[model samples]
Target: MSVDLPVSSPTWVSAFLDLAAEELERGSAFWAQVTGTTLSAVRGAQHEFTTLVPTDGDDHLRIQRRDAGGSRVHLDLHVPDQAAAAAYAVELGAEVVRPEEREDGFVVLVSPGGLSFCFVGQRATTRSRPTSWPAGHRSRVDQVSIDAPGRLLAAELAFWRDLTGWRLRRTAYPEFHQLEVPSSQPLQVLLQRLDDDATEVSVHLDLTTDDVGAELERHVALGARVLASHDHWTVLADPGGLRYCVAGDPPDHDVPA
Candidate 1:
């Protein structure tokens, strides 16, 4: 497939990139205060950064576990036409998924190399603009840092790189191997390995809800285990034991390994 980025992107792409950068910086600063560790960007990966913060402070976890790859590392593009978007994805060799219905609008999708993304409609007047990320006023946030199970970081990364044509954003270290998306937004998918199935090996989902506690309670009613809870969010392990979370804010926790 001949992958082509649009000659012109929505005005919001630039805006969103700026916002994403800001939020990353802000997140770094916030984490720094909490951990007393310095923040730094990984070399050679534009917009890819990390912090060396302490794990057990500020009621926050002692070690901050973060990487930019996982099932949730998706983007929501607002194209003028959903069908056109799907067709474009097909042109890019992405496998199209059904355009599902949501309360706000419809989601048309295509997963490039099994990485999923949605094309949502501009249904409401007050919709989230991608540029709001840097201002820390984002509407939709997507960053996935997965915990892969084996010594397959290099192989997995090479597969994705061959599949998506996205360049490597960072090298493999004790923790993660990072990939870059064209835009500045939080389009990270992490590959992590867990011990003794501490968390289930499944694609986990994270949602920003009105009330973390209330939503946690609701999921509990539906039979989800409360794995971990903090002031910012509540972690829920699904019946299948996959770990996910709902919170008032984005995931900025640092869990030391």
Candidate 2:
């Protein structure tokens, strides 16, 4: 039976930067500075969630603090009906983490490949623009890179492709696949295959800048330390202990074949 996928694909909403409470303030502050966004009033019973609001666009970034756990980044998907989306996700191999639906229509589920994300009931239509710094560079933290171990990458890639209703394209690198989402969407996902099959699936944010070298310096000045440098991207550890990257990839929206 051919399954209809168009009307069911969820919208990419926000990326959650999950850090320890102690590091939450520091991390959220640092992220706010780098992304050129302001912190929204913290919400949640424990005062654990905050939004990174931009001056001209709908929010696509958020922060979450955990009572105890290592820092990590998670994705959020917005759908017209979150409950229906959650059920569809389960039918597509996602396991429910928060089985009882919340009043807000937020549903948490772990993808078959082990990546955890939420299905949100609301929507974000205004995409954020890249910020221009006084020092002479423009950048936008507009992508979430999903790192899946070699053996699981294929399945994970397919899952994300169908879930986002994005055009899946093969990149120049055999290890990477691009989910070509609508350019109007605030964020996109890049599926990267890791070398070790035993390595767990994880995610990180990617900020694209016109001047990678300058952006690298700016990040370091903001307390991010370099982990490694590639020809087009630099991996770094954020002040909150989360890992992300700064890349010189042009915002041309093309995934090289």
Candidate 3:
């Protein structure tokens, strides 16, 4: 099987914020404002998809209206020969969830740990940059943390690392294995080993912000709630009830100010 994925690695990754129909309006607006983006015209078979168009670079975020789910995050890997990438992913233990979607060049898949993502052509070359806000604070939706059960962590890690061919590295947190994507790539990847409690895989996003305090306050004023706080990061639920984090100073800035 000759599956030719992008030769330079996938440059664009669009994280899809799947929200319940009732939350679409509020969620779309909230995400756009928070990320310094404008919502693109609605497009999809059922008018269920909208891209968050950024001001400085290619798009890397999208919102999807779902009929029933509360709120969830899935991503689309934009690679050349999407069909071949889907096939390659299947060979690496991913299960195709929507073969029918391939007619239009979209194919959904579930990872070994059961987290859902799909494939699309790698059309965007420029990466989405961090947004500048009041007080000159900069933040970008940078990473997606895949939370997996202890029993499945090993396989999950193997599947993602192998599938993306990214450098697998250890993180400060013992439970985390970060996949170091090239700076050209839109989103970073983190595999978190969870306590052997949950039976299913799940995902949440992280926005690397230079000023966490300001970001938190701004987000709260825009209809977000703090779930928990740590020295390095703060977790919150957005207006549409989707959870994410305002992760402290990005990884690139290793030294303290």
- Using TM-score, give the best candidate's number: 2
Model 3 residue pairs with clashes: none
lDDT of 3 by residue, 98-120 (tens): 86354467888999988999888
Provide the clashing-pair count of each candidate structure: 34, 0, 0
- Per-candidate TM equals 0.35, 0.92, 0.91
RMSD of 2: 3.3
- lDDT tens per residue, model 2, 3-27: 4665347665588998888898889
Give the winner by lDDT: 1 or 3. Answer: 3
- List lDDT for all candidates, in order: 0.41, 0.82, 0.83
Clashing pairs in 2: none
Q: What is candidate 2's CA lDDT for residue 63? A: 92
- For model 1, the superposed segments whose C-alpha errors exceed 4 Å read 1-141, 170-174, 184-187, 196-202, 208-223, 229-234, 246-257
